[model samples]
Target: MSKFKYIVVALLLSACTSDDTDTLIENSNTLTNYLQDRSVENGAVIACAGNTEDDTVSVEIFFYPEEDATNYRLYETSSTDVDSNDFLNYNRIFLNDAPVFNGYLRKFTGEFTTERWFIVSFEKDNEIKLSNPIRLKNESQPTLFANAISINQQLSQMPLFNWNVNSEMNNAIFFQVLSTINNDLISGTYTYENQFQYYDTSNVILNITNGTPPDLVLGDDYKMTIMDVSVDNWINEIFVSQFTVE
Candidate 1:
């Protein structure tokens, strides 16, 4: 996008999230200055999925970065909105300790709370690329596809996943994550429809950012989870299933 358009979007976002008039103006200026000289693109950060268990939560963040990208960084805040300038004050999260999948997805597990926000960035040739602010929401209800879907993993071919839903989705967006039994993310994407045959680009919204889909290890156990996120960003339902690649 043009630099002017990028700054305009940032200014509007800052205004919506800042309650104080002075803070809004300051945030607007910060965003304007930060994005002015940078190359900005939508979908740099595509999708985020979270799992909360009791008092703890695990979040999977996905991003597309340049092949030469280095010095990957994550910043955190307790506020509702975050901009590039906010990263200066936001606490940096060390990703060296997090599990990485396909060199694009990162997983972080920690105590659960209602007020945490995150943003991701990476440096390529000394220029930093930023991702949109992301936050995870708690699940609202069990998903209809809990035990209603069937997956066929054929050797040398993509897996075929089909499901049956008995209720209305209420216009929710579907997101799927394929992971190892130990919770290592393999591939993740969004689908607007109910059925997603693995690696079928036509049926998916945001295809995996990894250059190529990683092969699922035969005879090894794996997990598949599908979450429905509403327009408000809340997770309305989730389906988690485990299987052994036969």
Candidate 2:
């Protein structure tokens, strides 16, 4: 009788131990796979000013899941303060097409100024997975001038270019002049300092007397592009315009 009682007690203890072990395993799995692996990409801040009418901005995101997630949702916010819920707005949401991971693209466009902030968020399984933010600024536009030109009396010297001087340029604007023969390849290159609007009493001009000339072959077409300096050196909202060298 004593042996039987001891055996029964041992069996009960073993069952309790097994139950504890199973509980631990379940809790471990929940902690390990609690959230989805989500990330943000190509986040940028765009600025616009002046008489410009339309512009577009795009952003991309990539999400990875530990297991098969059937549904996902995306959210956007516009505040720098993370603690505040005032910026919450549903911009986009979609379901997963693939099982494990994939990429998502988002785009937003409108007239906005320095007063606004843009934020993007991603949610999976009702949990916030990722967030990204960008800040906007109103930067001054730059002015352009045509410096020097050479003219041939036999050729038509209708060399025209357009530019705007920046009143509030954070740094000097860099310029590149491109020219092509027969419209196949660029024949010449020129670089100049970006001029300030204060220096221009009138419109900025490019002329042959300045040592720059619009001498072209008879009956040949030419094209020119006066592009903005690299975005790395300048702030946002720096406007640039181009003209043809007739």
Model 1 lDDT on a 0 to 1 scale: 0.54
Clash tally, candidates in order = 0, 18
Q: What is the C-alpha lDDT of each candidate?
A: 0.54, 0.30
- Over all chains combined, what TM-score does candidate 1 have? 0.57
User: lDDT per residue, candidate 2, 49-87, as tens digits?
Assistant: 121223322222222222333333333334333422222
Residues 22-56, model 1: lDDT tens digits: 54345542333444445554325433435553332
Model 2 misplaced regions, further than 4 Å: 1-36, 39-76, 80-107, 111-114, 119-133, 138-242
Best by lDDT: 1
